[model samples]
Target: MPLPKAQTLFGYSPEAPELSKAEVSRRFDELMATIDSLPTRHVGASEVAQAFGEGRGIDFGARPGNAFEALTKALDGPDIAKAMSSDALASVTSALEALKAEQPDLMKDITPSSPIGTGLVAYDLEAPAKMLTPRPTPLRNRLPRKKGIGLSHQFKVISGFTGTATGGVANIHPGIGDTTQTNFAPSGASNALYYARGPKISYAGYDKTVAYSQFSVSDAVTWSAQYAGQGYQDVRQLSRTSLLYSSMLLEERMLLMGRGTSGRGFLGAVAAPTGVALTARTAAGSEVALSGFTTNVYVKVTSDAGDFGQSVLSTAANVGVTAGQVVDVTCVLPAGATGVRVYVSTGASDPGDASRWYAGRVGYNTFTLQGALPTSGVAASTITADTTAYTNGYDGILPICTGPDSGYVNRLNAVLSNTNPGSEWQTAFAALYDAVKADPDRTLLNGSDRKQLSDALKTNSSSNYRMTITQDQLTGVTLGDVVNTIINEVTGKGVAVEVHPWMPQGNAPIISDTLPLPDSEVSDVWSVFNVQDLLGVDWPVTQFAFESSSYWMGALLCYAPAWNGAITGIKKA
Candidate 1:
């Protein structure tokens, strides 16, 4: 059948032109040919213009089709810009302005004059500078603190034996009479026959003077500076805090080595001069070639009443000897001397030479220098001078522990050889714990002393001190952390090794116990008797500027001197 024209399909005309079957076939063929002649894929702008009319598609031969591109070309060409319509040019200009407002030119050079280039343009600065000064108060923090109602704190200590049981056991025949009754009789007919005299109890009283430290600051700073622009905001508050720290330092020194010569500071732990006195040598023995001696050396003796309590060195006696010859000296035994320590000078003629090398221990008054020369020993200068009548200050820990009263025995040599740096410390600590019969909690020494111990441990190959590495754990490697504690071989308990910067060199104090005194409580070993804690007040001002002051009043009281002791005369590692 033949198809009608497009006007007939729309019902525009019922009698629309209809062709025969051959004419209709020819028209369909011609339509298909026209569709094939058109582009099957994308064509360029010129091809599109040629395919469609120039006015309908794009004027590619004359100008760009995009309004942006056409505007850019017109800007460079005055003739093209004149030909462009005002509305089209206005639209492109509006778009460019909008873009300029939204996006800044970040690629532009930044100069010193540019406000955006400066870092402080909108920066927020911190108010005050941080304070990094180191202020450590180890002893003050550990000791107990208590309040006192009076100006002085006093306490009583038992000094002698008590009870009436001085008689010893005795054997007697069953028939005749008991010998115990006769042996237990009173002396000088002062009491009834066969009745033993009672033992009188003795006590020693001790008093501590309250000490104080104060600081003052000018009030003018408070008014002159309101903010922290100069690093500190409140000068008065800073001064108060600083005073508290400095006062603690003063108190700590008094607790350790104070010699209250001025009657202001309290007595310290190593300030007592209570060693047995040796005025002069009774016999300066003959010089012999027993050991190699390069120069003349001084000799001194220390008496011990059998207890670990060692006395201070006696007066140094100069014994002139040449190289390859050693001096042999003898002295009358001082009363109450159960044992004696012999010391020699390190080739110095000065009788008061600070360095005193340990020669040996002797039971008799006679001492013979033997073996090679000693390379390490205690320094006499480090030991504190004995105070007269103990009125200068209270006897510190060293004198109390090594004095005749406490019975502390120090039998080991005072020197530590570099070849075996850790041996003396380890042995001394172990012996100290055993003598005290308690596990020591801490061992306080100088940093140099601790370093020596640590270095010795690092080089030691003993399994007890070193760690084992296996094949299965070979990926990650570490050389082990520095050890800060040592386990007692006897008690199997670890004692913390603390390095105290303020600790006197050559003195290592072993503290067996410590208690936390939160508020007016007491410690087992020591306490701080406080007449008044840290207090501050603004002083009466006569001028326009005012002043403030802070103060602390307290004294350190050692309860049990026997429970704590020190390893003195430590020269180095």
Candidate 2:
């Protein structure tokens, strides 16, 4: 029966053999090596041939002759011939054609030359190596040796006042009577005695001395006179005068103190000068005495007596005073005294005794001296202008124009800087057109004017403006869209778009030994074309497929010799 089929003979079968572990392992290794060595273009063909060979002891070599013949015979063999009908043959032929057609154009340009046998080597073989020259020493030193110095200063001044006042007399006098009679005779001698001296005869004056003697004439007369005076005149008068004067003399003393102390202890507190003590005796048998008042007051004493002397005592009544209490003695500076001194007296009287007082304390006024003395090094100097130090340093430069001018200058500069040059005319025109389209401002430019403007911008020179045009023009298009557009535009021009996704920008990946079809290209094609249409024989194949095919073919060519090397035990060329 047609020489039993290989599967039927010697226990061989058409169904894939249940290979032993060792056999399977060996077969898999051989297949892998074969696959690795062949060109990618033959990958499908080789696979087909291998399936046939494994099933029917056929051999497919690197050259198509033996492999193709073996494959043809295996298909037509008595046991398998019926399987290889006209339809199967046609399908295989079509697949082969499709695979061949997918080969990249770049592959045809490659010309491998034998370096050992050919005399047409492009590189020089006997050229001597040139010795590298040493770099010359630097011409000048640029390191900084010393740093510069900077210093600043400032000053401040403060001044003001405090004082107190007390005690005056309340005087009273009798009212004048309407009667003018000097004397009157008495009915009783005792009553006459009360009117003795004839009612004091003269009514010219109500003097205390005159009225006293006339009142001693009788206790009844004296008592009546006192009652009449009770509701009469009341007057207040100063019983004692005390003055405290601070003049140029006192200020001079304070300034001297300040200069001696530096700024450390510039402030001083002065207590009131001495004054007489007031004592009162009560029925409780205890003595209540009032000594001098104590208050913490301050002043800015300076050499400028003009300003210092103008200082007056501030009111201290609100600070330290009681209802029954009184400032019996006022603080004063003696007329002949040279420096500042405090004096005191008793009973609101001026003692005129300069020795009765002493200087309790002295103070230096920092406020007055602050203005006169130079500022300390620690003070901060006010900055009035930008400096060169800011230009090269991390500190930002202070703009020359601050407040109002900054905004105006910035806007003006921006507008001026954006003006298109002649070379960037096209880019500028495109940008303006885009802007107008987005927000058509007829008031800004009429249709005719816009066209003219566009024409002018088209001739302008500016890379920045050109880039703007590109972005604006491509608005929402994806990378795939760009490829499609390029392909469409370049089609029918004999030159097809060589889209090498894995290629470096300048050197196309089409020439690479291993190129992969970009997902973007596949996605883009799928978007516009049906999968069935793409697989159809007549549909145009993509550049990505072509490049990937060429890459695989190149890889196969390079490794073909390696396969022979493995079979023959020779080193690959």
Candidate 3:
């Protein structure tokens, strides 16, 4: 059959000569008649039924060239010579006509389409800015973190030797024979003499203890919230960061204040008062009127010197008076005591109950009980009966240095209200360094205490001094907003002062990184022991939302407590 002319196929052509509409219609009809007169080609069932072989014998190259060619071959067979046969052409044309009927619904026309209008708000079209999370946890980040073994971390502390020395040397002699007499002494002797004993090697057995603590944090995110935050933020990651940080802040607090709910928290670095007591005197004067003194009640007071701790019960004062009678008990406050808690016995002489205690500061130390006596019970329990003692948490530096039996640190009483307050503070600081005979890594104090120290320095100085801060091409000058250091006269070294936000005001602790032990495996004297370090996990979503949690199981360990020292009872000038 002859091919249709270009002008007849396209109905019109730019380069072709103009032709009558009747001539073009006649050419198109002749092309259609020739195509329809072609012989029909049929695919046999045997050929279409052939299946692809498996294994190495399978020929992947036997696949049809493309989807269109494959469909055409399946319906008309692979004979290129008869590809345009009437039956084969009709089968392909029928399939194509069906596809064309659905083309308008499935395909989009881009020619007539325009960009979206500008009437929408800018906020809706633009992406959001990045979010910010600021975490201010200094002690937790600064203290060294380490991994521990078993349920608890154990270590041995060697205090001193218990061996005794033999002053004078002894003489020894062997049995004398006929010809020669044996003598082991500076002077020769005939009689047999002997020193009775072996060498004595004795030393103190090391004290060993275990440290352990654990805490956890959890959070949840709804499906809708997470899905809504898809492009704006990663809600899951943000939740994880927040949870982990929250856990760390708790750990930091525990490091400072160890007495958590049931004493299951980390042991703090500061020590609880062990043996300090206040002196008591009882008389009937006018400090405050007594209220519940129907019977004779025994009064005892305990002192809390800054972060040192609430001291043990003091000497009981027996006051005999009726209800509403004035009970004035003059008490002698300890050298460094800042606050006091007064406990009264329900009976004549039993102050063991923990329910009848009244809390008071130093100014409120006067006992003014003015209520009718309802119930009479024993005295309140001490810090030891409950689990408030330093058991779960390790004994921190402050405890090790200032503990009753520690004999390592020099405890100096500072009076900030003295006439020469600056000189007094300087003397106390110098005394502490002098006792230790070395400088500390850094001096930790509350922000209020730091201000007091700075004020003291300014008051002590001869004049308001200022240095000329000249800046040139190669020179630069830097100034501090506040005084951050003090000079230790003993060591002639500048003590670096750091403000601890959580530290209890009115006291400053000088901590040394170097342990007193000659051979220490730990690099830092103070370190956090982790049986299980920080771990985070996501729970399987039961509903449309998911929950995540994080855990940190550890305790603070102090290798050498004596190397660290603190100045207690610091009153801000």
Best-fitting candidate, measured by TM-score? Answer: 3
Worst 10 residues of 3 by lDDT: 162-171
Clashes of each: 10, 24, 10
The list of candidate 1 runs beyond 4 A from truth reads 1-126, 159-177, 182-189, 196-232, 262-422, 429-439, 461-464, 469-476, 490-492, 514-523, 544-546
Total clashes for model 1: 10
- From the highest lDDT down, the ranking of the candidates is 3, 1, 2
lDDT value, residue 375 of candidate 1: 54
lDDT of 1 by residue, 467-503 (tens): 5543445586554445488776666778788998766
Which stretches in model 3 have alpha-carbon errors above 4 Å? 1-134, 161-202, 224-234, 259-402, 405-438, 461-481, 516-522
CA displacement after TM-score superposition, residue 76 of candidate 1 (Å): 27
lDDT of candidate 3 at residue 188, scale 0 to 100:
54
- Tens-digit per-residue lDDT, 366-388, candidate 3: 34444443244434464443233
Candidate 2 stretches greater than 4 Å from native: 1-62, 65-85, 104-124, 127-573
TM-score of each: 0.47, 0.10, 0.48
Scanning candidate 2 in windows of ten residues, the lowest lDDT window is 209-218
